[model samples]
Target: MTKLEQIERSIAALCPKELKAFAKWFEAFQADLWDMQIEADGQGRQT
Candidate 1:
């Protein structure tokens, strides 16, 4: 199976509490990525 499929299966196996924690972590992870992209865009525009 693909790595993504493995990740999906592993996430599906998480218990309720673990899933909640993972969701929170994932949200923060996404937010950080977004912030970094915005910063990079701003820097590019300054050139």
Candidate 2:
């Protein structure tokens, strides 16, 4: 299976507390990714 699929499976088994923590972490991770993409765009880097 793909790495993403494997991660999905792992996430599916998280306890409520773990899930909440993961959710928080994911939000920050996505935000950072978007910030980097925007900075790259501003610098004229091809995505």
Candidate 3:
């Protein structure tokens, strides 16, 4: 199976606590990605 499919299966098996932690981490990761996008935009780079 592909890596993305593997991750999807793993996520489906997470317990409540684990899912909460994963969601929190994903939120921070997305925020960091957005920050980088904004920084790139400020530098006039096409995202």
Candidate 4:
């Protein structure tokens, strides 16, 4: 499994009930970081 999937599986096995919250936060964090990276790339290309 991918690292992310492995982590999720581990967490799920340990705390099934909290998986939803973990997923939500993980998605938000990944999306925000991706947006930042894209924005940075745009800035870099413009410079």
Listed in order, each prediction's TM-score against the native is 0.92, 0.85, 0.92, 0.61
Q: Candidate 2: where are CA atoms >4 Å away?
A: none
Per residue, candidate 4 scores C-alpha lDDT tens digits across 1-47 of 79999977788686655888888988999999888888989888521
Which lDDT tens digits does candidate 3 get at residues 5-43? Answer: 999999999999999999999999999999999999999
Of candidate 1, the 10-residue stretch with the lowest lDDT total is 38-47
Note the residue pairs that clash in candidate 3. none
RMSD of each: 2.9, 1.1, 1.0, 4.0
Q: Which ten residues in a row have the lowest lDDT in candidate 2?
A: 38-47
Highest lDDT model number: 3
Model 1 Cα lDDT, one tens digit per residue, 1-47: 99999999999999999999999999999999888888988888521
lDDT at 16 for candidate 1? 100
lDDT of 2 by residue, 1-47 (tens): 99999999999999999999999999999999999999999999956
Number of clashes recorded per candidate: 0, 0, 0, 0
- Which residue ranges in model 1 land beyond 4 Å of their true spot? 45-47
Order the candidates by lDDT, highest first.
Answer: 3, 2, 1, 4
Runs of candidate 4 exceeding 4 Å displacement:
1-13, 45-47
What is the Cα-based lDDT of residue 13 in candidate 1?
100
lDDT of candidates 1 onward, in order? 0.93, 0.96, 0.98, 0.81
